[model samples]
Target: MNLRMKIATGAIALVSAGLMTFLGTWEGNGQNVVYADNLARGLPTVCKGVTKHTSPVPVVVGEYWSDARCAEVEKLVVQKGQLTLADCLTNQQISQNTFDALSSHAHNVGTANTCASRAVGLINAGRIADGCRALAWAPDGKPVWAYVTDAQGRKVFVPGLYNRRRAEAEMCLK
Candidate 1:
């Protein structure tokens, strides 16, 4: 079946491997314990970037999760993110690469924000390349979703996030 059909029928049974690879490359292997996400205002995260906001399991600071547990949580999180992306992109046909790229972006920045962003809007409007570009930068030349609050409460651009977004954008173009 085609991407649109699978999305429309909710028949995409599993998260795409590309998304798993993307998350692994960006979020790193499950830390095996919760650590403060410095980029997210010190949000406690574990297991391939699973945080309180995103994890199916409860997340506690300093809590340990074995590799098996981390893999479970990561799978669940990625599946959930895929559902969110599918919902947001309803009726829109996209490549698996595009879906994986957007899923990773949504997983990082929050699905709600991603769904409402110019990227989604552009994609829904059939401007696939424009949407991909929006993942890296806004039309105003500002980095999109690449800033994090520093300890001093100043917004600082994170090169890692910028690079990730650029990579995701490039993936979508492939």
Candidate 2:
């Protein structure tokens, strides 16, 4: 097979796997009394719950959004600004200038031990970006930017997910 064909085959496999796992998780988690919707999206890591805060936490991070966290970001954007105040936080430093930098920096990695605390730590320690790229990414295993409609069907303009999803692909059309 040619290089392009090989790469295309690999991507189809990844999307299939991700979609299957996502579907199964939705089926498993959806039956609960809480989740408002099923068929929700999954990120690179579907970490277990975050450990309790131990203090001196520079910032909290996680691999995937709690179904609730997704909803909260959605609510704030609709009520307040394009991006929520919480969206501005990053391990690098919390400053007005940092917001734009955040999206350029984030990339997701799937972890069995997923959790918000770990996610934040990865973001802070710079592991999230480094580790994701370090993984055995095929030409296709990059993350996709989702419209991320929330419970109210509003789009949360999360810059990090947007950029990472785009950058992970061919990187640039040019």
Candidate 3:
């Protein structure tokens, strides 16, 4: 592989079916409904977790869309997210599964934060397995980032986030 081969020019599937399906399964593929995202302080979300920040167009709480429209917007959101993820990643070739897993991770954590995370740094240092492990665990082998701040500012572990991170880490390792 060329040394400069990045996701844009490499064989990394930017919007592969596998990624779409994985996102749909985890993000909830509602046909045509917009609702508040409890995980995000009740941000308005629609069509497989498309939020105002991620959507190309404006997202309203009660906005309605057709099934095709939902898919289209979701695709656009995913492409934008994957492209941002590619930009954040090092200019080295990676497996489609790893790229997809990282893209999903980035989608959840925001690209800027994900780019600055220990996982990305480990991957850039060529410790791929360690990078994957860092997605869910700290260097001391304790789980991390699986919590939500409650209204009282208490850290509450979200089982769903834990499961999702574990799955993403497994996919990255593969």
Candidate 4:
């Protein structure tokens, strides 16, 4: 092949490789299906419809957790047939624009971390709609919260689950 053709071919290969890596583990479906199944129960699934709406989830950050014995509910969220935390939070009741911004923020914080500040910022900036929204609350019984970890995994929980709200969002932040 000529130099131009070789360069074009190399570019295509590089793009393909990058795309595959970005997709993470998948079977043409960006899903770590095996990984999901192999984990213990309550490890959180990426699937949305299957997520229990009223399910009580364990909240933990660093080490403190709500009901130290309970586990976090695990659910899978898929975007474009590829499962991702970004897809789950976005696709679930939340709007598309919000989803995009949240997705970007999640990426910036590493999908798993998906910092609570992003959600708080959205609400504070008035980008998010007014109403009840799900967020991990501090264990002390306040409104603000950051990251929630459990014996199973770490994730944000819907609001109603708390009696008066777990703890304010501010308690968990560093």
Candidate 5:
């Protein structure tokens, strides 16, 4: 190659390498399936209608899902969660772990709720530690009251939500 063309090629290579390094440094790897698994662990499949904690809407009987079906739902949930994070976060760059945690949180609480939550606000404000803490308290800030009134007038906490929040918080901190 000519001297000028060689220099230009070398410059392009350097730029590409730098860009790849920069992207690698930021832990934004797409781990949607992992996040969905975390969510599924938190929200187990049930064969009957049940009320999800802190959510006014009840999970209808027909909505109960498991196995592949559950995975499909979780996939959709993670997608929504990602969109919610994109919409809510303005300046903060998030890692794969952070995305997984937040996606799971959004799946449980909902995209709108997660976007409007204190966690998102804190994250946007550059208070990542505080944001993780807020994510831990995602159950409407009530970790102790693991149960809410179901459609049958029964007060019972949805299984695994508290533990799920804790896991999400830990993931965020990582």
Candidate 6:
């Protein structure tokens, strides 16, 4: 197959896998749950029988999980994350990869912000490239601020968030 065909095939497979994972149909291991970058980065979580936190802090507490608990939390988060995207993106037709990537970002940032974001505006206007580029910015269409405190307790830019935005932008392009 040609390179284009190969890429198309791979994207399809990825989308299918992502959908299954999001829907809780695909059972992932504890490692998968623990290693999800967004999860570890202090994104909002939905643990069963546990009240969800409104404003989550950006730190991982490793001592707070059993294998069963981790899996349950992962599934709940994934399902809720997809729902957030669906709610915000009502009536819009987007590719699976775009949906997955944007849902990941929206999951971290919040659905309200994602719904009102410049990226969504651009997307709704059918300016796909511009919309993808907008993913690198904050939801308000400005540069994302650095909130991570440094050694001296001063806020500093987080390279990880920058990298994550870049990855999301790349995925939107795909």
After superposition, candidate 3 runs with Cα above 4 Å error: 1-10
Put down candidate 1 lDDT per residue, 24-130, tens digits, no spaces. 89999758889888788789998778999888678998889999998888888888777767777853567778888888898898889889989989998899999
Number of clashing pairs per prediction, in order: 0, 9, 0, 20, 1, 0
lDDT of 3 by residue, 21-128 (tens): 888878877647788888788889887778899988888888897889898888888888877777767737467888888888888878788888899899878888
What stretches of model 5 exceed 4 Å from their correct place? 1-73, 138-147, 151-159
Q: Write down the lDDT of every candidate, Cα atoms only.
A: 0.83, 0.30, 0.81, 0.31, 0.50, 0.54
lDDT of 6 by residue, 1-174 (tens): 432233355532222455434323212333422222332344323322112433232224333456566545545555555565565564345666676667656655666777788787787677777787788876566555224555566667666666667777777778
Alpha carbon lDDT at 44, candidate 5: 25
Per-model root-mean-square deviation over C-alphas: 2.3, 18.0, 1.9, 16.0, 12.8, 9.0
TM-score of 4: 0.22
Task: Give lDDT for model 4.
Answer: 0.31
State how far residue 118 of model 6 sits from its true place (Å): 1.0
Top candidate (lDDT): 1
> How many backbone collisions does model 2 have?
9
Candidate 6, superposed: residue stretches over 4 Å from native: 1-16, 19-51, 54-63, 138-155
Segments of candidate 1 deviating more than 4 angstroms: 1-4, 8-13
Writing each residue's lDDT as its tens digit, candidate 5 over 1-174 gives: 432233245421211232222222321233222221223333422311112432233444335344454334434444444554555666435555665566556655666878888887887788877788787665366663234565566777655656666767887788
Model 1: how far residue 167 lies from native, Å: 0.5
Model 5: worst 10 consecutive residues (lDDT sum): 27-36
Q: Write the per-residue lDDT of candidate 4 for residues 1-174, one digit (tens) a residue.
A: 432233245421211232323223221232212123221234332212112222244222223222222222221222321224333332233333333333323432334545345453444444344212323333253444333455557665434323212221211120
Candidate 4 Cα outliers beyond 4 Å, as residue runs: 1-82, 86-91, 115-174
- Decide which is better by lDDT, 3 or 6: 3
- TM-score for candidate 3, please give it: 0.92
Q: TM-scores across all candidates?
A: 0.90, 0.22, 0.92, 0.22, 0.53, 0.59
Question: What TM-score, to 2 decimals, does candidate 5 have?
Answer: 0.53
User: Compared to the true structure, candidate 2 yields what TM-score?
Assistant: 0.22
